[model samples]
Target: MKILTAVCVMALLVIASAAWADAPKRVKFTWSGGEAVAELNGSPSAESLWAMLPVTVDFKDFNGVERIAYTEKELSAEGAPESCTPDAGTLALYAPWGNLSVFYKPFRESRGLVPLGRFVEGADKVSTLGEAVRIERME
Candidate 1:
């Protein structure tokens, strides 16, 4: 009886592991020479950005502290209020210009800025990302 119970538990564990492996993945960014994983924070603006995945844009150094890219695709700013300034390695949407900002250095708060997802990997190298970046869902 004990052996049968052990086998049943092992089978359940295997099933659970398979389910987890097949779960939907987060987003990722890939460039010519590097890649980074990102996780969203459940904001509507972030959702809008996620909806428009598989996008490619050229990133350029902006304001001497952040890397900015023009997506040309507008994202919803609803439910995201103007809050405190974002820290380094934060990804935000500059609503005023309708562009995406990947901050490599700290900056003061500004209106029309919405919080998006942040790079989980390769964040420290954000400032060094070269031109032509592709954003897409992992799977």
Candidate 2:
């Protein structure tokens, strides 16, 4: 049946496309506002100046002593770039000069806190304002 063959092929294509869409997209972590600019491909070589894990990163109203206010042990239904996956075991870190958050893959554990990701605040996808690096990766 010609129609059946065409339908099968279309179904296969749809499945393939779905798989492709679910795959992670490689992206360089945006830590430009922090002291360390690192890439978040889950590579071992990335470096961070000020951030860590087993904690939640909170951004205060631009801080001189912006204390960490919360700890997000689990992030659910959160939108992430292709390179990031929010799992219960996802490790967190940051750059030293700023509150840059990094989500590392399995290999990056205990590597002296390297940065593999970051989150920015406000409407600007990229925030560059004042003495503060508005971009910070929380715990």
Candidate 3:
């Protein structure tokens, strides 16, 4: 009985891990300085952004802590959390203004900010991206 139980547990774990591994990657943002890849969360807003991939936009520094870009189209904020506290490399959508925000420094919790994802690489270069940035889906 013990052997059978262990085998079942191990099989379940393998299946779960396989499913996770097969999940689709999110997006990558590139600029003159460097590139960063973000692993998006399972949120409506994130999905909306994903649908508009391979876009180019201009980014500007904001509050000395992050970069802000106008997405032209507003993302869905339904089912998003009421508030979010951003840290370095955090990516989010500012619902009120319908802009995309990428943090390079920690900030206070605020409402109407929808969590998107975080930079998995080259986060340090986020603060140095050129005015023009290209975002595309990662395979």
Candidate 4:
């Protein structure tokens, strides 16, 4: 009976995990010459970002590694894990500066950087994007 109970619990866990994975939060960004599609993670920071979507910002190249932009609103970072070695096409928030970071290149992990999402398509174009861009929810 104990073994059966454990199996049932595991099965429930798997179903829950699968349900979570199936829920998608897609976003998109468009600039003069580039566009990208991304999916936001189910994090508080990501949720905050989503709330402020359909915003326009002027993105600038930072450290030759990523495009950076600043938003007027500050996002909550409570319970966010330390970030490290962000993969290309990653979207993150730099808490200290309250700036948004869209990584075009891999970077070593750093504190105060909270992951927000990842690109699902057109990631390659992000590295070359510049000037004013519009970000909005795709779905």
Predicted model with the maximum TM-score: 3
Clashes of each: 0, 11, 0, 2
> Candidate 4, after superposition: displacement of residue 97 in Å?
1.0
Q: Model 3: how far is 10 from its true place, Å?
A: 22
Model 1 residue 34 lDDT?
81
lDDT of 2 by residue, 37-113 (tens): 22233333222222233222343322321122222332221222323332222223332222333322233233223
Whichever of 1 and 3 has more lDDT, that candidate is 3
Of the pair 1 and 4, which is ahead by TM-score? 4
Q: Estimate each model's TM-score.
A: 0.78, 0.27, 0.83, 0.82
Predictions in order: lDDT? 0.82, 0.33, 0.89, 0.88
All candidates: CA RMSD (Å): 4.2, 12.3, 5.0, 6.4
Worst window of 10 by summed lDDT in candidate 1:
20-29
Residue range 113-133, candidate 1, lDDT tens digits: 788877788887788766889
Per-residue lDDT tens digits of candidate 4, residues 9-121?
Answer: 99999999898667878889999877899899879999998899888888999998999998878887877887646899999998878889999999988888999999999
Candidate 1 similarity to native, TM-score: 0.78
Alpha carbon deviation, residue 83, candidate 1 (Å)? 3.3
Cα deviation of 81, candidate 1, in Å: 1.0
Candidate 1 stretches greater than 4 Å from native: 1-25
